[model samples]
Target: MDMKLEVVILPVSDVDRAKDFYAGRLGWRLDADFPIEDGYRIVQVTPPGSACSVIFGEGLTGQQAGTLHGLQLTVTDIVKAQEELASCGVEVSGPFRDETGAFHHAGDARRVPGAHPERASYGTFAAFEDPDGNAWFLQEVTERAPGR
Candidate 1:
């Protein structure tokens, strides 16, 4: 069977604020905003050119707000992606190369200044967060592995 990942449900403290940050600041396409019973609401947003989307809603999750970590987005150009996210008021960090020359972890210990010297795919990244501090990483993957 083929299984495709579709959505991630982020836990947020305030629905409207989180919605604004994802849909407005990050410029994700607003897919839906539906109000259900008992004052609950569901909001869905999709990143540009992505098949997957993220969602958040009242009463939808037990996860704490700001606890989601290390979600990643891939792009062809790290610098351009960082510039665009920063321009959108997203507070994106400068692209960095991990000290281990591999994927980065959740803290600053793994980060060093500037993009990878050769701009190797999956080697350079920048980071940002949503309003409730759900961290997201932008990774540069200029060339995919064979058959990807």
Candidate 2:
């Protein structure tokens, strides 16, 4: 039995604003945006080349907006990804690496200034946030680890 992760629910304060950030600013593909009934709506967006999608809107999740973190996306080039996001008017912070190799990323204490010395796969990363402050990390993964 193969179970696949399909979608992640995002708690957002405003539906249109979040839509603009995800679909307009970040350039993710807008899969759906439908109002179910009164005070209820659902919007789905998928990052390019990703199998999983993200859903956000009204009356869906109990989690507070701007409180979710640790959502990550994989990229082949950290620098390029950061540049692309900055070009899209998104505030990006990185091209940095974990210095201790322990991945302790609670704050900036364990973070180094730049990418890994050898540009190692999964060694470097970048980050950005949505309009609702949902944090997303861009991990540089040049090659898949053992069967992906």
Q: Which residue window of length 10 is worst by lDDT in model 1? A: 102-111
Q: Please identify model 2 stretches exceeding 4 Å from their true place.
A: 102-104
Q: What lDDT, from 0 to 1, does candidate 2 have?
A: 0.88
Candidate 2 lDDT tens digits, 5-95 = 9999999999999999999988999999999998999999999999999999999999999888888899998988888899999998887
- Compute each candidate's TM-score over C-alphas: 0.95, 0.95
Stretches of model 1 off by over 4 angstroms after superposition? none
Tens-place lDDT per residue, model 1, 16-130, is 9998888988889999999987768899999999999999999889999999998989999988998898788878886898989998867667789999998888899988888
**lDDT (Cα) of model 1:** 0.90
Q: At residue 56, what lDDT does model 1 achieve?
A: 96
**Model 1 reaches what TM-score against the true structure?**
0.95
RMSD of each: 1.0, 1.1
Pairs of residues at least 3 apart in sequence or in different chains that clash in candidate 2: none
